[model samples]
Target chain A: GIQVEQSPPDLILQEGANSTLRCNFSDSVNNLQWFHQNPWGQLINLFYIPSGTKQNGRLSATTVATERYSLLYISSSQTTDSGVYFCAVAVYYGQNFVFGPGTRLSVLP
Target chain B: IAGITQAPTSQILAAGRRMTLRCTQDMRHNAMYWYRQDLGLGLRLIHYSNTAGTTGKGEVPDGYSVSRANTDDFPLTLASAVPSQTSVYFCASSGTASSGYTFGSGTRLTVV
Candidate 1:
């Protein structure tokens, strides 16, 4: 079984500030996704980066498969961004999708 | 209306009772999965199906069962609900094992 760990278990940022969240996995992954669970508990897909970098507006993610870690960047954060961000991964040809504990971000206005 | 749908947005059940959680996806994905999230913990896989007629256990499959009789629906059943089973359950699907995923809003279940 592969293990997943996320850093900065909790974070508090002022609106308009920038922050970075990191996720590290125990093994190589064939699938990886960044998800945001809003305060209302709706899961939103942020990105599906297996081995490269992707940007979605003010949010972006970079995954170094070789290093077995991924980084998510949130720039100009807003109050709406106050929620938990999760990183999920499926190791090489495995059907199991393991999720990290998540980075709880609170963007204060 | 086009993505995954989970029924009974939330439910409260008595211990030892049997209950089924419904999940349906219209994306025609080849793979579906069930995961449970506890308070302050990340989601843990309970079961998964690669395609229709095939299913496999996940990291936390004990006491939980899943069946994929067709392509659109994957229902999870609990033989006897327990207090520890009270958690948020999420249903997700992907075109394939290596493809992108879509998750349901989640079913918040509580056992008494």
Candidate 2:
């Protein structure tokens, strides 16, 4: 089994602040995804980057497979962005994904 | 298409009762997974089905059983519920292991 760890277990930022959350995996993976768990407990997909970079609105993600790490960037954050961000990975030749502990964010008004 | 639908958004059950969580996907994906989310611990896999008729245990499958009768359905059953079994359960489906998955809203369960 592979291990996934998230840095800055907790984060607090202002409404217009920018932040970066990091995820590190213990092994090489063929699949990696970032999700935001809202207050309602719905896991919202943010990005699916196995080994590249992608951006969606005020959010973006980059996965460096060789380095076994992924980063999520949030710019001009809003209060709605306050939630738990998780990074999950599926190791090569594995059928299941392991999730990181998550980074809890709080964006104040 | 409904990516995935989980019935009984929330449930409360007696410790010894049996309960089943229903999950269905309209995408015709070949792989489906069941996970339980707890505060601070993240989401832990309970079971997974790679295809129509095969199922496998995940990280936390002690009291959970799952069956894949068809492509669009994967139901998880608990033979006998326990208090520690309380958590938010999510059902997800993907075309394959390396692709992005679609997850249902989730079913929050509590046992007494």
Candidate 3:
């Protein structure tokens, strides 16, 4: 089983601020995705960067397979961005993905 | 128009009772999965089906059963509910085991 850990378990940022959330995995993974669980509890997929960089609007993600790590960047954070961000990974093309505890972000207006 | 849909956004049941959570996907994906998220914890996979007529156990499959009789539906059944089974359950589908998934809104189940 692959272990996934997210850093900065809890984060508080002011609106318009920028922050980076980190995810580290214990083994090589061929599939990785970042998800945002919004205030209403909808888990929205933000990125599917297995080993590269991807940008979607105000959020972006980068995964370095060799390093077994991934980063999620939020720029110009807004109140709407206040929620939990999770990173899930599948070990070397495995069928199941293991999710990290998540980084709880709170953007103050 | 193409996504996963889970029925009974939330549910409450008594211990020893049987319950089934419905999940349907219109994307016609080859892989479907069921995950349970406990309070203050991350989501843990309970069961997954690589394709129709085949199913596999996940990290936490005890007390849960899933059947994939067709391509569009994967229903999870609890033969006998327990309080420990109370959690938010999410259903997801992917084109394959190697791709990203689209998740349903989820079902919040509470067993008394």
RMSD per candidate (Å) reads: 1.1, 1.0, 1.0
Off by over 4 Å in 1: none
DockQ (CA atoms), all models: 0.73, 0.72, 0.74
Candidate 1's DockQ is 0.73
Candidate 3 Cα errors over 4 Å, as ranges: none
lDDT of 3: 0.93
**Which is the leading candidate under lDDT?**
3
lDDT of 1 by residue, B22-56 (tens): 99999999899999998876788899998999999
Error of 2 at B87 (Å): 0.9
Residue B15 CA displacement from its true place in model 2, Å: 0.7
Docking class of 2: medium
Which residue pairs clash within candidate 3?
A: none
For model 3, what is the error of residue A52's alpha carbon versus the real structure, in angstroms, after optimal superposition? 1.3
TM-score: model 2 vs. ground truth = 0.97
The local distance difference test score of model 2 is 0.92
Cα deviation in Å at residue A99, candidate 3?
0.5
Q: In terms of docking quality, how is candidate 1 classified?
A: medium
The digit string of per-residue lDDT tens for model 2 on A23-106 reads 999999999999998866789989989989999999999999999999999999999999999999998644688899999999
TM-score on 0 to 1 scale for chain A of candidate 3: 0.97
lDDT of 3 by residue, A1-58 (tens): 7899999999999999999999999999899999999988899988988999999898
Count steric clashes of candidate 1: 0
